[model samples]
Target: MRMMDRRTKIWILVLVVFCALCAGAFLILRGIGGDGTVAVISVDGEELDRIDLSRVKESYDIEIDTGYGRNVVHVEPGAISVTEADCPDKICVAMGRLQGSGIPIICMPHHLIIAIEGDGIDG
Candidate 1:
């Protein structure tokens, strides 16, 4: 009976440790980025397009028509920036270059979002 009780206690401890590790991993990954395909770009919560890694351009510019105004998206080598926005405060442009896969560039006034995502196996 004593041996059985010790084994059970050990198992419980092991299970608790495993759960903690899993939780830690979850939080860490969430902070850095998502595990799978996140979002590349979305407008008004409606995804307009995705950035194709294979077809990634060294430099490109995007113009968004927010109905209320216009937002220009610019991406250069190693960095991306927003040049112009019709918003009262140019917070999105001030965000500077964005390279994280989880976090996205959000223009609340325009309801536009841009993010980095992993290429699907099929992609």
Candidate 2:
């Protein structure tokens, strides 16, 4: 077996420390923007509704009919999604459920934006 030189061992230790710090930062940032419990629904830059998913006990649907188009929002327990839409691409409906506080569900044709907002994690 060959022993690593002093410089090589120091470099390896520095690399390990750097990786640990990076992982810590990532975890902290992820926790800061954890899975949100509040969902905000908007259309054409107008704030329409805000639902707290944590308090939801039953599943329901909200129909949004704007001048641009129409969309059906489904809310259940701790999740929200666009189940139906009249847009040309139908991308919003295909976005599935809102997961955490990351990318929001957007419908460009209808000018709709559904986003989850909060710093607290969903239990």
Candidate 3:
């Protein structure tokens, strides 16, 4: 079997270490999302509403309706959740409180989706 030269061995070790470090950084950063300027609300891949969470409370439990009926959502500090939904089963509401920012509370029956958006998004 052929053996690698000293320089080649050193280079390979460096590359492996670099790759491991990169992977570690990625995992760490993925957990620490940026406090960007906007948080969007969407449903079924369609943009429904936009909210500005800047200066917003650590947690919130609010309701939104389009003149038809009422729905409830619970927004915990840094995250939002649906407590009780007007829809049957209230599955979304029962899903428990969301503990993250950048996500949304969605109700498919009403074609409604709520996401966390920044002040930059248009009405």
Candidate 4:
């Protein structure tokens, strides 16, 4: 077996430290965008509404009618969803409520996207 020289050991240490820092940064940034507190609604890539889910007290529905089609968004404390939509596929309604920073609810037929975003984060 061959022993590593002092310079080789130092280089290896530097590489380990660099990798550790990169991993730490990646974890911190991932958590920063997790468990979002707001919901953003958009159509055709244009923002239509931003709702603070944390402050919501009562559940309600929003009617969105655009050139593409129509959607009914249900909003409640800490969550939002598309309860009804006129799109042919109805995939947005099937997506269910927005939870955390997972996949967003999208209505491709209507060009609508409902996404959850963390504080100060835009979707």
Pitting candidate 3 against candidate 4, the one with the higher TM-score is 4
**Judged by lDDT relative to the true structure, which candidate is superior, 1 or 3?**
1
Candidate 1, residues 41-103, lDDT tens digits: the string is 677666666655334558889887867668888866445567899898888888776754444
Q: State the weakest 10-residue window (summed lDDT) of model 2.
A: 114-123
Error of 2 at 106 (Å): 0.4
11-96: candidate 3 lDDT, tens digit per residue? 99999999999999877654454444334555445654444544456766567663444577655445656677677657667566
Give me the displacement of residue 6 in model 1, in angstroms. 43
Give the local distance difference test score of model 4.
0.86
lDDT value, residue 2 of candidate 3: 88
Q: Candidate 2 or 3, higher lDDT?
A: 2
Writing each residue's lDDT as its tens digit, candidate 2 over 1-123 gives 799899999999999999999999877866676677789888876889999999999999999987799999999998999999988899999889986666679999998998788666331
lDDT for model 1: 0.68
Candidate 3 — worst ten consecutive residues by lDDT sum? 114-123
Model 2 regions more than 4 Å off: 1-32, 120-123
User: Which candidate achieves the best TM-score against the true structure?
Assistant: 4
The window of 10 residues in a row where model 1 has the poorest summed lDDT is: 30-39
TM-score of 2: 0.69
How accurate locally is residue 4 in candidate 4, as Cα lDDT from 0 to 100? 90
lDDT of 4 by residue, 1-123 (tens): 799999999999999999999999877766666787778888877899999899999999999996888899999998899999888999888888886776678899888988888764557
